[model samples]
Target: MNSPVVSKNAEGAYSVKAPLRGIRKSCKYIFSNIYLYVDKNPVYQPLQLWSDEQVLQHQAFEKEQGFELTEFKNFEDIKEMSCDFKEYGICEVTDGSLPDMTYHVSTKEHTLTFDVKEK
Candidate 1:
């Protein structure tokens, strides 16, 4: 059999690196598919996943500006929205949105916070 394409290493052996922003882990490609990684372990609920085409579009947009752009797994994460506004009546925190690398969610009238690894 062939050897593992990407065995574990000191920094975790893998050709593709996780996205440095809010994106899902479900959406994927051969490598450099941060969307796939985020789909598995998303910071926000409803787990926003992107298509390979979408990733390409986003990258292309950034390239047009001649600079690396921050990527988000889900569109909701990049937008200014708050699930808490309706769920927990919290005006500050929100759900489906990663704020400063943190995700706030409401469950049974209670809001919870989860730390995330976006990059």
Candidate 2:
């Protein structure tokens, strides 16, 4: 059995080094968030993980689907409505206490969070 090796560095800092010899199993998670915009031009704010081109593409797709992107009064209003775009990453609405509505999604690429202060 190999034991942990301890050594002192030039800075007089002692450290114990653990051996990493076994096969390590790990998990990686990717998350994304959708923010419901409550302004005059209400929109479920696009995610940061999406590129500008992707956003434009999604907008085009939305138009093609005849999905009327309407403004919502609050989080509940958004929750009550249905989303037409799911191919572009918009998912079900989640419950939150923030000023605006918030939605979350998880994928293999990255994680996401929505901020109310962001206009």
Please write out the lDDT profile of model 1 over residues 37-97, one tens digit for every residue.
Answer: 2223223334333445555666798999998765544433343334332333322223442
- lDDT score, candidate 1, position 33: 23
C-alpha positional error of residue 53 in candidate 1 after TM-score superposition, expressed in Å: 1.0
Candidate 2 C-alpha lDDT tens digits along 1-119: 24546566796544443332232356432222222232223335432223333345566877899996432332223322223343432333334323333222222233222223211
Candidate 2's C-alpha runs over 4 A off are: 1-48, 70-119
| Error at 71, model 1, angstroms | 2.3
Q: How many backbone overlaps does candidate 1 show?
A: 13
Residue 70's lDDT in candidate 2: 30
Misplaced by over 4 Å in model 1 are 1-49, 74-119
Model 1 CA lDDT for position 104:
20
Which candidate leads the pack in TM-score? Answer: 1
The true-structure Cα RMSD of candidate 1 reads 14.8
Highest-scoring model, lDDT:
1
Error of 1 at 46 (Å): 10
